[model samples]
Target: MSDTSGSQTNITDGQQVQLLERVSVAVVTTLPCCVFLFINVTMLFTLRSKPVFCETSRYVLLYNLLFADTVQMALGHLLYLFAACRLFLTYPVCGLLILLACFTTTIAPLTLLVMSLERYVAVCYPLRHTTIITIRNTGVAIVVIWAFSSLNILTRVLLLLEFPFKDLESLQMKEFCSGVYVLLGPRSKDYDRAFICVLFVSAGVAISFSYFGVIIAARSASTDKASARKALNTLLLHLVQLCLILSSTMFDPLFMALSGILTRIVFVRLYRVLYIFISLFPRCLCSLIYGIRDQTIRPVLMQHLCCGFLKPAVSNSK
Candidate 1:
């Protein structure tokens, strides 16, 4: 009797520990997510609040990129919360959420590619930058990016249709909803891997070309030394951001690989760490990089972020 009682106590203690861990993980992730979401939302508002932001081509691209990242971050967090809470969604429902997340995920790198090229044009062809990087052209690029991403989503939907959904006892998922779990077959996985590889590789090449093109242009005596230097710095930042985004994509596979080796407790701890840094942090980088670094954006973004507190100070100074 004593032994049985002790075993029950042990099991109860273990369950309590797990509950504590889950709550801690949720708090840690949720707090940062809420903070970043606020900043991104503020930055988005700041972008649209001013005529300069709306009229400029790069700002238009930044708006589109930030919009995509904001959506991706929100959806990603929602999905993470659902999984943490052990909320099992229907296949159709889960697929929709994952597809939306995936859709936005593709936009970041592609927009970065365009942004890099825009910088390249600004440096290499200063005379024609206005002609080449017009607001109309920027809008068309945004449209093309969305259309390309939609086509990818459409292909995934078709692949999902091939799944034997009717054979299942119900539409309700048997496990936590994730991109890997939602993939109904090997073919889906293969196509996904292939698509991601192609997309990132192509974007990387284009961005790298732009980076080098800027470097070569910087060497020319004709180029504005200050402008070329700034573009080079921006290109370098873009490269780092791209690498971070690429690392975030590896989280799923990394977790899957580590799961088989690590005990559940260890795996859970590792997962929280990886998800925080790898998945969540990258989504917030755009706001941090652009909001703080850009001279034009910094003051306005700070004003919005501080809820107009800075406005009085600026007026007083002026």
Candidate 2:
């Protein structure tokens, strides 16, 4: 009787392990990549169909945000997939991925900050907005943002290359390349943490001020209630999107901290699931916030999709 009970317990454990493995793969790798591809493709098609959308500063910023999100999702998820498969990655390839990831990571929040400022100007200084946030100016802002992000990422990469790996086997390039591992010593880790915190805090403060200024301006505009309402709703959407993106950034460090407490196998599986969720969830929110929720783009997207479906049906009848 005891032997039979032990056998049943072993079978249950095996089934649970299999279940976790399947879940990890699906959540960490397959779902995020597929969803990001679909949404980004849809966004590209929508923009292509209506080229005028790119002319507006708001749309241009939003489109760039989408592009950044797509790139980040692609790189992060590909790395996760490789890690899951236990595949080896060359240093150059891994460094490139890390560089791109850092670039996108820096871009996302900065773009959100830009968007917030754009809305603030449009609402708070309606008369000056046209002069301030023109196509040329927006393009310049984007270029500056990219340059700033690249500089920061480049500095980090250079610093990472300088870190001594003599004492730490796990910090070796090959091991660090497999996952989102950084081989920073205590001092380096503190610096990295400070840099990230400062960056996020500054952006957060700017975003908060922008939104608050918009609210005050909107409230004072008693002549155009409809426009005020629309502006408020749009600002609300931006706030939600900012929160989602910020939350996604916390997952990696959070998982690393939690791993020390959890069993190894359990930590690995949970980290996989959480990592993909972190990468993909904000992207889905971005699609809804910028694409589907927008007054201009949503109609074009829906029309394109409908036309695509009806084309096959009409051809079949012919």
Candidate 3:
């Protein structure tokens, strides 16, 4: 309801619709971003103190994915916070950020796909793991995925920058969303349907298939039945989580393809709301997965969270 920069916002005084929606998004965005931010920053600093002995591509991919999600959740959500605080700058802000978010959003699934492939290599070709897979190589590949994703986003941003957005009430910062990234004018509106379809489909398919291959390869490994079972169960949980995250992205295109106006409105609103909440998951869940599920990683987290505190206590008592 408060437009700080005087640039015009979506909701007017009498219209109570978007005001409530914006408030809801702000709450969800703020709470989760704070929690995930703490977890991610804590993990980054503790990585050096306790190292995981293995040096596989998947290991490196895991850390890099964390790094990427931290950026997306912490810094990216901060962008929304700024837009909320300074609503008047919505026009140019919308212009600059929407395009950049395209890249950030795109790279997430791509990184997941890379992780899946690395897992596949580690399991399927265990003998060739050292020869074929390296952390440095995975890091380079991550850079490549980021570069490729950025290429598309930069192009989208360039296309969007040329358009003249008059700033419609529903398009700018209203209730359901904080950032001006979704602002759609006559020219810019082309982005919603076909464009999102391409980006989401490609990334989702890549991620899904990569994991599918990993699951298959893991099952085929010669590890003991008990170890294989544990690995499969863990991988299944990861798959379900990844699916939830990827499926949420498809909502945009799905909404666009719908024929009914009411359905479209409801879906788009849901899309924006889900977007704010879902983006936080990978950051926190990645930490939990690496820390809780894997015998290899849980100790590292425990050492950092527990040993760091307990060591000095025992020493002082002695």
Candidate 4:
């Protein structure tokens, strides 16, 4: 209660607020995502059917997403936790944290793009999917995704850290470090804004077109309405998954911008509240959403978590 009102007091710079938000986000993201990753990794081995080309390629994409998600989640949580405890995102460590956040954000979107592409090939080119989505081909694609992400982040980080500002201390830091350029100064962040706008549009178009092409190509003269509807529902579930991914990423960006401005203008700790909500709720719910929407995914998850519950009833009855 007092935290909100006291936000304006004893505030020489933003370092205190930044520390608070970072710590809060650390707790929110770390435990939930770590548990989710451990369960998913186990299921990949134990629950999934044998690796045919389509299945293998799908798992490849999923593994990439899980790896990237957990990496990003851990980075967001741990880096901030350590920084808050040690105040590391300052002086010598500032550049390093910026570099890492850049890379994590980059990998996240690339993995999503790969998942979309994998689904496209499977749905659009079924007969050829077996040949096209080989282990070697998937390995190459995985390498390309990581390579492209690393290069993109490297270039962007270089551009960001090289901002003409002489004193980073003079600039106001926000919950998200990436927003250093966006609201920290009087000038517009044209370079980053343009870069992000282009990436968002490009990703959006590629996702849309790939799915459209798949649906159109898979359209058949002899196909029944029921089968078509089933295919369409499967696509919807993927779309749902993609929506969660997009929302989760964009939420971080939104908080970054809004928090930078609010703390700058009103001196209120609104960002603190918002940061906690965004970090905890979205990541946890997004992971659980996969289990909720897809019947197959839901059962697979339940079998792992609830098999013991089922066993108790059977034993009692017997």
Top candidate by TM-score: 1
Q: How many pairs of residues in model 3 come into backbone collision? A: 6
For all candidates in order, the CA lDDT equals: 0.88, 0.72, 0.58, 0.55
| Residue-level lDDT tens digits of model 3 in 82-112 | 5444354445555465556556666666666
What's the TM for model 1? Answer: 0.92
| Candidate 3 overall lDDT versus native | 0.58
Give residue 292's lDDT in candidate 1 (0 to 100).
Answer: 82
All candidates in order of TM-score, best leading: 1, 2, 3, 4
What C-alpha lDDT, on a 0 to 100 scale, does residue 163 get in candidate 2? 68
Q: How many clashes (backbone N, Cα, C below 3 Å) per candidate? A: 0, 0, 6, 0
TM-score-better candidate, 2 vs 3: 2
Clashes of 4: 0
lDDT of 4: 0.55
Model 1 residue 137 CA deviation (Å) reads 0.5
Candidate 2 lDDT by residue in tens digits, 1-318: 999999999999998987787666756478667866777767766776655777788888878888888887777777766766556666557767877887888887788888888878877777888999999999999999899998887777777777665565542255535324653556556666786787788778877888677667666744255655666677677677767777776766787688789998899868766765666767766776566666677666666656665322111110
Of the two candidates 1 and 4, the one with more favorable lDDT, higher being better, is: 1
Question: Which ranges in model 4 have alpha carbons more than 4 Å from their true place?
Answer: 1-55, 79-88, 160-189, 217-219, 223-231, 237-253, 256-281, 284-286, 291-300, 306-318
Model 1 spans > 4 angstroms off: 1-20, 312-318
Please give the lDDT score at residue 221 for candidate 2. 40
